[model samples]
Target: KIPEPAVAVDAVSITPCGEGFPQCDFEDSAHPFCDWVQTSKDGGHWVLGHKNVSIHGMGPS
Candidate 1:
């Protein structure tokens, strides 16, 4: 199964930052919900581009 919507979006946006974005030492004033990030891409037709696993209702703490 695919992951949650957020994770996929985060993964795609964050992966280019070195696969450890948010968790890494990269500086960012955005991405407050970086803790709940999970990303996976399904080349198959079952899912959309990248699928993510993450929580909702989270923001900068």
Candidate 2:
């Protein structure tokens, strides 16, 4: 059986991105944006972080 509360999960974005997503430098630097996936928390979920966005979860849906 599954435990009452499982371990904590977290996913960090790849390069060209900040902890909360940085600017793309559209007309200055290379690599506009970044993209990644998180599977440790809920079975391979897409993650796209914004400048000032927060994601909250309540266990299972």
Candidate 3:
């Protein structure tokens, strides 16, 4: 199954993670709930596109 919802109707917006996106550094803001995080013998990280939502009381948090 696809892990996350593919589309959101009331999207707040899509923002680029910016110039050093996905590049690890000491100062990068931690994405504790990143959708594409994976773990195995060889660790991995991926940047999945995010659709911010502005609706209230719609889905479980």
Q: Pick the candidate with the highest lDDT.
A: 2
TM-score for each predicted model, relative to the true structure: 0.18, 0.25, 0.19
Model 1 alpha-carbon drift over 4 Å, by segment: 1-51
- Model 2 C-alpha RMSD to native: 12.5
User: How does candidate 2 fare on TM-score?
Assistant: 0.25
Which candidate leads the pack in TM-score?
A: 2
lDDT of 2 by residue, 1-61 (tens): 9769777669766676344554443454333434232437666445554444434441123
Candidate 3 ranges with C-alpha deviation above 4 Å: 1-8, 23-37, 41-61
Query: lDDT score, residue 15, model 1?
Result: 31
Q: Which parts of model 2 are misplaced by more than 4 Å?
A: 1-39, 52-61
Order of candidate numbers by TM-score, starting with the best = 2, 3, 1
Give per-residue CA lDDT, model 3, range 35-57, as digits (tens): 33333653343333335423232
Q: What's the count of clashing pairs in each model shown?
A: 2, 0, 0
TM-score pick, better of 1 and 2: 2
* Ten contiguous residues with the weakest lDDT in model 3: 52-61
lDDT of 1 by residue, 1-61 (tens): 9976663334433336444333433345554333444334623222112135433433233
